[model samples]
Target: MSNVTRYLCAAAYLDSGFRDKVLAELLFDQFRAIPPSYGGFDLMPVIYHCRRSRMMLVVRDALITGFFVIGCFMAPLSTFGWLWTLVPFALLTVDGIRRGPLIVRALIWFWACYSVFSLIFLAIMTALIPAAAYLFASGLPFSGLYGSGSTGSVLQQFLIPVVTLGIALVYRIAIYLTLVGSLKPGAPEPIIATTHPRLARRLDYIRRAQWGNVTMYANEDAFMGAGRIQRNWSIAVELDRVRESHKPSRRADPVDIDPVELHAFVRGRLIEMRDRVLRPNEGIQRLDIGDHVVTRGIFTVADGQRDRAAGAHPMIDRNGLPRFQATAEEIAAIARHPQGGVRYYQRVTINNAGQEIRDLDGNLVAPAEDQEALTSAFIYLAVEGRMLYTQFVVTVLPPAHDHYHVVDSLPTMTSGRVTWEALKVLKLQLLRDVLAAPVRVVRTAVESVRQSAMTPNPRDHIVYPYGARLSVRELGASESLQTHIQVLDVGKYIKMIEQRLTEAVLDFLEERKVETGAYRMQAAGITVSAGNGGTVNVPMAFGEHASATVNGLRPGT
Candidate 1:
C-alpha cells in the first residue's frame, strides 16, 4: 500500500519527466515492449522515434493513474468526478484487453490496482463489510489507507470510496476508444470502392497469411519487401471467388520458347514463355539493340544498315537533265532473266515439340514468286524466318532436295514434334552444279559517341581499325557490319577500342601464311572499280580503309 501510494504521488510530482524516465526504464526491462525494428542502427530517426513512442506510453499511464486517484476524491461530490475516474479505468481495461504492447499494458494493470484498492477500502468501511476481518485479511489497498475502524465506523470512512467508484463507472460508460491496433501496412486491399464493381473481383487478392497472403517472389533484399507486402494482400482476398485466368500463364513450360523461331517472320523479333521482351537501346543516337536480355531480343539485330549511295541512274533526274549510264556493279549484282524479272522463294514453319502437328496445309504457308511453286513450297516445307535469314538463303537453289516429289520452285523444312532422333536421321544432299565464295562474317553492331557540335551528325559511326590504328566513315562502318553503339562518337573512344579487336585478329592471321583458295573479301563500302572504260576511283569509304588493310594485304597475289 505504501509503495503504490508513493508511486502515485511520485508520478504526480515528477509528472512529465518521471513518466518518460519510467517508460525508458520499462522498455529496457521488457524486450517485447519495444516495437519491431528494421535493424538500421545507423538511422538516428528510427531510434529517436522508438524512444519517443515508449515515453508517450509511460507518461499516459502515469497521468491516468494520478487522475484516477483524484477522481476517487471527487466522486463523493459530482458527476464530472466519475468522468475522471471512468476515463482512466476504461483506458487501463482496454489496454489490457486488447493486448497492447506488453510492458505498457502491465503499467496500465498497475493503475487498475489503484482503483481496486480504493474500492476495497470503501467496502471495508461499510457496515455490511467485516472491518476487523478486512484489516486482518490479505492485502493492502491500491490507494493508501489513512486509518482503521469497526464496521459501523468503517461505513463513514468508506463514504469517499463509494462516491469515487460511482463517478468512475459512470464516466467509463460515456466514452470509448475508437481506434487502436496493430499497424499492418501496404497490404493489397480490395478495390471494392471502385466505380466498376466487376473489376474488384479480378484485381483484389485476399490475404490469408498472418502478415499477408500474396506469394512474394524476389532474391534481392529491398525488392523482397514489396513482394512480402503483396503476398500479404494476396492472402487477404477470398481466393475461391477469384475468376480463373482467361489465358494460360506463359511461364508454365520453358521448352515451348525454343520453337518460337519456327513461327516468327524472317527478320522478326520473338518473345518466349517467360513474358520477357526487348527494345532498341535508347543510349545511342541511332536506334540500336542495346540491351541483350535473353528470352527476348534474339531477333533484335537489324538485317542490314541503310544504303546511302547515290543512285547511278534514275527514271528521270530531279535536275532538268536526262540520265542514262547505269552503275555496272549495281546492275551486275542483280540477276535479270529474259523476262526482266526475278523469282524469289519464302517459307515459314512452326515447330511444336511432342505435340501433334495440326495440318495447316497452305494455311500457314507464305511465299513470294511464281504462285504455283510458292504454294507448293509453302505446302511442303517448314516455313521458318531466322533459319532462312541467318542459317540458309531465303531462296532455295538447285540440288537442295525438295521435301517430296520434285517441283519447279523452292523447298523448306518444318518441325512438328522434331526430336533429337529426327534431326540426325535426315541429311538432304545438294547438287554441286552452282556454288560461290562467301564474303563477310557479320560483326556485332557498334555505335559512335560524338557530341553533335563535334561531329555535325551525332549518328556518325566510329570504327576503329587495327591494321591502320584509326577510325573510318559511317557507310564503311555499316559495310563492315559494325555499329557505333553510343550516343556520341568520340575520337578518343575510337582510338582506344579500334586497335583492341584488330591487334588480336591481326596477330592471329599474321601468324598464318596466305593461301589462294577462292577467298571472298568484303570491303568497307570501299572498292577500286574495274570498269571496262578504264576510269576507276577508290571509294569514298577508303580514307582510313587503305590504311586499316595495309598490314594484312599481301604485297602481291
Candidate 2:
C-alpha cells in the first residue's frame, strides 16, 4: 500500500472518535493548495490578446484592400472616363474586405453579376451607336434625329459616358444591399471563460454531478476579522430547495415565475461560494485524473461520513447501497453479507490481497478501507445578504495545486455557479495599477518626497486613448487623498454575473423542458436607482420602522 494509505489506516486505528477529523487535518496540511486563476491570470489579459490577434488580421486585410483600391483609382483620376468606371468595383471590394468575411462574399457575388450585365450593356451600346451614326450619315435620318452628319457622332460619344454612369449606380446599389445585410451580428465564437481545457472540462463534469442536495456555506470573517460586533448577515443556500421550486407544475409556466427570486437565490449562493473558495478550508482540492489536473470540491460532508444530523440526504450508488457510511450496524451487516461491503464506501478501499481473516466465530472478515481525503464542504458563513459588489484588487502568481483550489474560478463544484466576486477582484486588480499610477506619482511628488515641483491641478486634463486620442478633464489634485473612501463598482460586476448566471439557469431549465416566460431578473445587492431619496435597495421589509428624535428633528428620517 502507498504511504498515504498506511498513514490513514494507522490514524484510523488509533481512535475512532477523532479518526476522520485527524485524517482530514493530516491530508489538508500535507496536500497543496491551488490559488484560483482565470484566463492565464485574469480575463483582461486573454481579451487583450484576442483583440490584438484579430486586429492584426484586420490590418493585414486592410493593407491589401487599400493597395487594390489605389491601383483602380490610378486610371480614373488621370484618364477619368470609361476605364475610370472600374473605381466603384474596387471600392466595393475594399469595403467588403474591411467589413469581414460575410460582406466580402456578398461583394463577390455583386461583382460577378455586375461584370455580366455591364458587358452586355456595353456590347449593345457599342453596336447601336455606330449603326445609328451610319444610318444618319447615309442621309436616311429625319431633321429632328440628326440635323447634320456630325450630330450622330456627337450623340454616339454621349452614350458611352451615360452607360458608364448607369453601371456605376447599379454596382453601388448592389454593394449597399450587401453591406446592410452584413451589418447584423454574426455567429460569434463561444465565450471562453478560461484557456485551461482541463478546468473547463471539470466544470462540465461538476455540472453533471449530483449537486441538487449539495449545500455550500460562506467563510465568515473573510473580509472582516472575527470577534467583531456585526450585523447578522450570515446567509445559507439549499440548492436543492432552490432547484425544486423551479420544477414543472401543471398550473404555471416557469417563465412566469419571477426570476428575481431565482436570481436572488443564486446570487446568495455565488457570494457564499466565492467567500468559501477564497478561504483556507472551504476551497477546492486538486484531483489528478489521467494526464490532466482538475479541481473537485465535496459540498456535503468533508469526511466520508454523512452529516445525518444536518439533514443531509443519503446518496445511493449504482450498486443499490447507501453511497456514504450511514450507520455502524449497516456497515457490519454489509461486511457479513455475501457481497462483503463491496459498495459500502465511496472514498475508502482496503486491499486484503486474497488473505482471509476469520472472526471469533470463524466468520470471514472483510478488510477495512482507509480513505484519504483532501477536500471539504464544511463552510463558515455569517451573513444574510447577497453579495452585491466587492472591489478587491490584488495580483499574485497562482499557487501550487496543494496550496489552493487552482482549477476553479469559484470554490463550489456545482455547475452554473457565479464567480462575480472573483471576477470583480480580477478586473479591479488588472486596472488598479493603471488607474492609480498617476495618483501615486503625484502623491509621491507632493506628499511623500516633499521636494518635487509636481503639482496636481483639479482643472488639469487626464489624457486617455479611446479609439483615437481622447482626453477627459476629470483628474483632480486631491483624488489620491480620497482614494481610501472610494466605493466599490459592484453594480457592474453584479449585472455582468447576473446576465451570465441567468442564461445558465435558463438553459438548465430548458433542458428539463420547463416552460419559461420573460421575467424580471434583478441582482440582489445594493441597488441604486435614478432620482432616489436615500433609497436603500434591500428587501423592502427591511425598512426603518422605528423612528426617534434625539433633538428637535426626527433622527434617521
The candidate maximizing TM-score is 2
lDDT of 1 by residue, 1-557 (tens): 11111122223212334434433322222111111111111112212323444334334334444444554564433223223233444564343455768787676667656655655554444433454456457475623234444534545444443543333322222111100011111112112243554323211211111122111111222111111111100001111111124322222212111112222222132112112335221111111111100010001111122332243222112321111222433232221211222111112111101112233363433332111110001101121321111111111111111221111111122222222222232211000000000000011011112222242211232321101111111001111111222211222222222232223222322223211111112222122445673322232323354422221122221
Scored by CA lDDT, what does every candidate get?
0.23, 0.29
The predictions' CA RMSDs to the true structure, in order, are 35.0, 28.8
Q: How many collisions between residues are there in candidate 2?
A: 16
Q: How many residue pairs clash (N, CA or C atoms closer than 3 angstroms) in each of the candidate models, in the order given? A: 41, 16
TM-scores across all candidates? 0.15, 0.18
Measured on C-alpha atoms, candidate 2 has an lDDT of 0.29
**Candidate 2 residue runs with Cα over 4 Å from true position:** 1-51, 73-116, 119-557
lDDT, candidate 2, 1-557, per-residue tens: 23122222222222222333322221222111111111111222222223333333234334433433443454222213333344334444454454767766676657646754664455446445655676768866444344454455444444434443433233333322322221112211223365767445433332222111211112221111011111111122211122336663443322222223333444454444334466433321221111011112212322222233342223332221122223544433332332321221111011111233467796878753212111111112111121121111111111112211122222232322223332332332222222232344454345435422432221132221101010000000112112111212122222333354445454544544443332112223223343553433332122368322111112222
Candidate 1 total steric clashes: 41
The local lDDT score (0 to 100) that residue 401 gets in candidate 1 is 14
Residue 252's lDDT within candidate 1 is 27
